[model samples]
Target: MMRLFIGGAVLVALAGCGETRDGNKPTGEATAKAAPAGWNAMDACATVGTPAVAAAMGKAVTGTALDPVSQPDGLRAGFSMCTFTLADGAKLTVLTREAADGDAYDAAVAAARKIGEEFGSPAVDVAGIGKAAMWTARPAALQVFLDDRRYATISLFGADFMPDGSEAARSAATAIARKLAS
Candidate 1:
């Protein structure tokens, strides 16, 4: 059951990276709002190296890539992702996006919930991370709605993975979100 949740979450997260039906990338204006005053969208990867992340992994983490992956055509400019490789070959990924408004955030939450329902997994409401967050049990993934205009996801990949409620993953996510919010 746990493996199924993790797998489903990973698939959903990956699905968000594909081109939209229109085959267009999102414009900067569409995803530009909600970034903290000093937040540099391009430097999102740097923020993943927080002590919280280190503490969560219980080992040193090395960043493998800091680049933008394919995004839904409607959100081309609104998405960014960073990945780090752990010593045991596990992976930690942080994905950020710019939403248009509350509607958009709501849509994202709904979509995530649907994914969980499809797989017979439940999405749990998580407190104190952002404006709102949904933790999917199957995939052990955390999606945070930082505000109407911004949100992020934290995911872990590898065998012997932690659940979405794991303290380490949650703490690391909170740390990264704080950096992005700043």
Candidate 2:
């Protein structure tokens, strides 16, 4: 009887061990939980920036829902701002904000342009309309803007980037720009 009880307890423990824990593998549900479904890495960044700039501006620029990473150099400070998804399986990182004091903005812009140029993307595959852009080392894209009045420049860096819903990003930018203007 004693041997049978011990054997039964061991069997119960083994049975529980084989059970799958929540999110054991990269299944549809697990992937969905890991990241937003139907969304790529770039889309993750693009969807950042809130619509309520008028209210939120001037107080304090708090952190955002989308996780932001900052890379600061002597001449320029780059921030991964927007994130979005692409048709292809690539995660995009939208880098924005290159702040400087005097000629820092210009230097930042030059650095950014140089970085993009160095990417040396082959002929842009999209309809091959314009010159073939250079592809960055990582799967990424960039949108750069200079704010002369604010003396700050911003770059939208994308990873696994796509042009989906650019209008949405533009609208978000408008709000952010307005805030920055003030």
Top-scoring candidate (lDDT): 1
Question: lDDT by residue for model 2 over 1-182, one digit each (tens)?
Answer: 32223223222222222123343421112111122232232222342333342232222233333434444343333333443333332222233333222223333334434543443532111211111111222113323232410111122223312333243333443344333333
For residues 67-173, what per-residue lDDT tens digits would candidate 1 score against the true structure? 56444344333556677777777777777665333334454567766665664658777776667877665465677777665667777776645433465555555
Cα lDDT listed for each candidate: 0.57, 0.30
Our model 1 lands, by Cα RMSD against the true structure, at: 5.5
In angstroms, how far off is 45's CA in candidate 1? 0.7
Model 2: ten consecutive residues of lowest lDDT: 26-35
